[model samples]
Target chain A: MNIHLTDQPIDVAAVLASVQDEGAGAVNTFIGTVRNQSTGRRVVRLDYEAYDAMAVHQMRRVAEQAREKWPMLCQVAIIHRKGRLEIGDVAVVVAVSTPHRADSFAACQYIIDTIKQVVPIWKKEEYEDGSVWVAAHP
Target chain B: MKLKIALFGIAKEIVGSSQLELEAPERQSVADLIAQLRAQYPALNALTSFAVAVNSEYAPEDYCLRENDEIALIPPVSGG
Candidate 1:
């Protein structure tokens, strides 16, 4: 249960280390980074906002669901950055540890995927001429 | 009854505020709240989609609303 929503830059190393275990044979991680472009627009940066308490709670729910599916999971950690972020900045990190490599990969993927869909977090892309909230409109 | 809803991301921008206070009928469901909001803020219809969260969980349309429940409008999430 290492879910977090931080305004500061994400500490990927610390997150990975938090899930380390002596008995775990595999550790898997997923890092999401801001891109410089979207569609045809040149993105300068992105502004992320979250429903603070709910976001953290939803993230924890994702971890719990993953653990229930993969009981062998030894540990899980998820961190998402809020506020303005420049291109190439790390936006989110998900790390997990399990006794076997297959379960580690499966659990890690499930956590990130579920968080994307269920977490109450959003990112707005700032372009040279204008800005738009990502996934907000058709 | 009156209910206050927390808005985030695009919902905030459309409403021009992070928090919204609205009048709701008693025994209102999540779907009823959304319908009323859409009537008040037609701009919300432009959004691709959204979900209503009650007490930090993704609530269904039929989910009943309580007076003091923590409610939030969750626009399509893009967080990685």
Candidate 2:
């Protein structure tokens, strides 16, 4: 399990490569991007802020849960960002590897959805006019 | 007996402080501290939608608590 918070975009290929193992037959990844529009408004940029300690901790918890659910899950990698982001910027990444495809897919989705619902990271939506903070990933 | 607890996010901002020491029965869970915090910090009362974690791990509503644990009060998420 790996969880990190950096201002830099996560290297999806690197994450996938690191988790590759001969024993695993399947790998699934979920990448979240900055959407161009929201609530009928065109977004100019986005700023993500996190209680880093708690956010990383929450990501680890998600990995642990996936491991418990499927012991065959070989590895799990979770990366998120904190700071200003523009459209197409990578906001979050989740990857899971297992011996079978089904378990990997199920576990990957569970991890992403759970992190959104439970984690405490907040975002400031920067529009052309102004910005506001609100609960997202519900 | 009582224990020391730490707050974060909007809770810390509302309290105008980072941590607080409150009196509670021994072996109280995270929920207990939250109750006291809500009573003492009126600003936090308005934010009923919150989350908690103990020692950086997400704590469910029924999660048990301990003394000196770094309990975090997390506001709603605004992430991707």
Candidate 3:
């Protein structure tokens, strides 16, 4: 189980290594970082929160779905950061390895997409003037 | 029955607490819980949408909540 939710910065190299396999021909990785601006606001930092137990459970579910869809996938690693993060800080990483290149790419993308939709995690954007929970309002 | 609703992100800020205690009937559904909560914390109604989770899984509107079941008010998630 490579899924993790930590307050510390994500170890991208470790995540990539977690999916290493001799038979795997491709390892695909998706890294999400905090941006300097959002919707034209100069973002200062982001505060992330999560329902710890449920977030991990949802991430695992997403991983399982990806594996079921791409049986050739050898391994999967998903890591999400919590607490405060500055611009350019890594927020999440999804790495996948497979016997071929296509499955690895597809599974990695699928895992991140599903995690965003289903995972019980939230991020608040802070600007110089005010802050808001991203996507909290229509 | 007594229910403790866990709040997160904006929901927590609106309620000014991470957890809340509510007194409800034994047969309260998820929808009933939401209505009660929104009335108590009107700011929650302003959010685009929210979800209810029972014991860590998303619960349907009509899902009946039981005692000792973990319940949470989930604001719109923005994780990447």
Residue pairs with colliding backbones in model 3 are none
Give the residue spans of candidate 2 off by over 4 A. A136-138, B1-32, B39-43, B46-48, B59-67
List candidate 1 segments past 4 Å from native: none
lDDT of 3 by residue, A12-112 (tens): 99999999999899999999999999899999999999999999999999999998899888899999999999999999999999999988878888999
- Taking all chains together, each candidate's TM-score versus the true structure is 0.97, 0.79, 0.97
Worst 10 residues of 2 chain B by lDDT: B4-13
Instruction: State how far residue B74 of model 3 sits from its true place (Å).
Output: 0.5
In model 3, what is the error at residue A123, expressed in angstroms?
A: 0.6
User: Model 2, range B1-80, lDDT digits (tens) per residue?
Assistant: 65666665556657777776767787777677677777777766666477677778768777777766777777677565
Name the 10 consecutive residues with the lowest summed lDDT in model 2 chain A. A129-138
Which regions in candidate 3 have their CA more than 4 angstroms from the true location?
A: none
**For residue A42, what is the lDDT in candidate 1?**
99
Interface RMSD of each: 0.8, 3.6, 0.6
DockQ by candidate, in order: 0.90, 0.42, 0.87
Q: What digit string (tens of lDDT, one per residue) describes model 1 on residues A49-129?
A: 988898898899899999899989999999999999999999999999999999999899999989888888899999999
- Over B2-68, each residue of candidate 1 has an lDDT whose tens digit, in order, gives 8889999889988999999888888799999999889888999999998899999889999989889
**Cα distance off (Å), candidate 2, residue B10:** 4.3
- On DockQ, the stronger of 1 and 3 is 1
- Return the candidate ranking by lDDT, descending: 3, 1, 2
